[model samples]
Target: MTAHQNGTISAEVSDFLLNCFVRSPSWQLWLSLPLSLLLLLAMGANTTLLITIRLEASLHEPMYYLLSIISLLDLVVCLTVIPKVLAIFWFDLKSISFFACFLQMYIMNCFLSMESGTFMIMAYDRYVAICHPLRYPSIITDQFVAKAVIFILARNGLLTVPIPILSSQLHYCRGNVIENCICANMSVSRISCNDITINRLYQFACGWTLLGSDLILIFFSYTFILRAVLRLKAQGAVAKALSTCGSHFILILFFSTILLVFVLTLVAKKKVSPDVPVLLNVLHHVVPAALNPIVYGVRTQEIKQGIQRLLKKGW
Candidate 1:
């Protein structure tokens, strides 16, 4: 072959090989559509429930008010991440720009942290209701609940700022393929060329500190609640008290378990199937968001009745 022809053929071959290597799996893209639809339905249901409660004057109690706030947060969480995720999956766009990716990571962390804080606050609210029935009104006043909600938003929102800022400083080399569905902190961290010792340290410190604090507070609250329940002379009173706290306790355990598993799984170096990790990622976010509305709405008679009434009115 002539030298010019040989050179042109070699260049063409290289371009083709590069494109082949860069292509992502089509199945992953297909999966995102149905998942996005599911999330959309869940968000819609949650919003409807929140609106129903808000419109009804009788449902304006502190507990329901806090729940409405949680539903708002859940809607934000779902809306913020799912659309972009669906786009990425459907378009087969494996790579995200640094800034966009950072934003996604930040918002996800913010909402997740907010959810955790809300759960802890809910536990405290329940504790007061069950353990200090006489002073429940005084202890968990409307003003106190408002302040708690504000604090939950402020504290968790600020906590996530550092993660994205710190992560943005790290350099990523050519091999930046993410294994999971979203651009999660750990997954992005794995692609960095610079030493991630600080990142890893920060994760461990933050993860355990937040988790430990929440767990301790929840445990203490429930302990007092249990003690108070035991002292109740009437079986019906005991049952009612236990029922009120039962769903929240189960949700707390569920959140703690999945979070612990996700963090631990990120620490490992072994190759995991992308599907498994992606499914877990969906569960980690969706379950907690969807669970709050379902559990509270189902378990609380006032909320259920309010929703039913609203529905009957064509709301």
Candidate 2:
């Protein structure tokens, strides 16, 4: 439990301090109300969507399966970050055990990467569906879906595990005050007394490699999709094509926009208040999770019909 000389710090490094942006204690509890609402909405929406997808056998396509995976990741992301965040905000519980902090950090990193990977799989699904509809049936088959799942899990899990590992290997001799709501990698790493260049570079590399590549490929996918659609040159064809990608584009847009904003906020942290980046980081987890199912699940015709049938049976 003590120092490993080049590895771990002394066992005295017990807990890390988790910080948030609650101005006044009494008024801060009020902020939890909105956050609670978001959590409820997100969890409820994703759960209901999962049940709908499960019960409705007609929704057994690879696209829907991928959508279900997205919902599942959303659940994991929200659960990992938000509840502890609420506890911090409402109950003044700012101290997270060393192990717990690392676990949270790991989950956050793994699932964020997973979420991005899932989106890429999803975009590829869309690309095949639109760009090569005739081959889509064979391209996005059961085996394909299974492989996509494996890739998403394996890539993100393998790459992201290093982030928390690298962070944990550092010595935390300094005070463990994390200047954010969640146990983010950079937040936790910045508290270390040791040099954080490797930690910073690795995080940067992972972000650009995982998220950047996903975004680039997804962008190319939709670009090709749009090109294919425009080449149709028929009346109402553009609208029809846009409609298919509309929901996905919206969800992916929100996903990328929030992440970009978070990165920008991190850079401009000096210009703005510290709480802004922290708040953005916290919101990035919830807002996407909350909206993912709503945009992809409820808006999809089959899922919508399934929900309607469920409600009709209930009523």
Candidate 3:
């Protein structure tokens, strides 16, 4: 793989080594406990939420159905990256095969976008519930949830497939040591001998398009929702409306805030330590996953009641 011919090395690479926070070994040691806890929390919480939603017939509504989709995506994101991160931290298992690396990259790319799309749909769901209450039942139906799920799956799956494919096409002569924990598209492509301009440009375009569009729509939905919420003159109406959206809004903030910080750090990479972005990148995967179900369970009365029933039945 290292042999260079005509300014390019062989693309037939076997495995890539992950350099996961190696500069500060103590940092890994400190991080291992919290990271493991977060992984367990994410897995357990999402599983509980999924099972609760499934068993509770009342949760078959569009909002809960969308929540289940988010939980599923959270589970996928955690399983994709956290176990390997824990392995790297504890057992020093940093070597990932070429195929596995690219597969991981694809999942991270696709699932994250799908999660964003789901969030957008959820925002629309809330908008309808709050702004057009009378029509929400008809508008956000089983059919609507099904079509939204299909859109998320198709859009992210089709758009992000090219990222890993383009990345794999590049020749990797600059050693197989990936500086980040996971096979981040940029991290892997940076190690390639080929000009990664196309890869970088395409990734930027697609990523921003997916996330940007989702965020914009979410903003508009919430804006209309806010306007509708403010006009309510009935007692407790504003509180009820805000409470309904509180959990989703908090999750969206956590997800988008971390991502925004990561992007800003990447832009100011020259000023910031390189590890900041890497650390944020890793946290971005697990933190929201860990928080999603917990927030919903605590804030949503129905979910809390459903969980209580689930526990009682299990016991």
Among all candidates shown, the one with the greatest TM-score: 3
lDDT of 3 by residue, 154-235 (tens): 9999999999999988888778999999999999999988899999999999988999999999999999999999999999
Candidate 1's displacement at residue 264, Å, is: 4.9
Q: Stretches of candidate 2 above 4 Å error?
A: 1-11, 22-30
> Where is the poorest 10-residue window by lDDT in model 1?
11-20
Selected candidate, larger lDDT, 1 vs 3: 3
C-alpha lDDT (0 to 100) for residue 1 of candidate 2: 32
Error of 2 at 310 (Å): 1.8
Error of 3 at 197 (Å): 0.5
Model 3, position 53: C-alpha lDDT score: 95
- Lowest-scoring 10 consecutive residues by lDDT in candidate 3? 1-10
Model 1: residue 30 alpha-carbon error in angstroms: 8.2
Ranking by lDDT: 3, 2, 1
1 or 3, greater by TM-score: 3
Q: Which stretches of model 3 miss by more than 4 angstroms?
A: 1-10
On lDDT, the candidate that comes out on top is: 3
Q: Which stretches of candidate 1 lie over 4 Å from their true place?
A: 1-34, 264-275
Q: Which pairs clash (backbone N, Cα, C closer than 3 Å) in model 1?
A: none
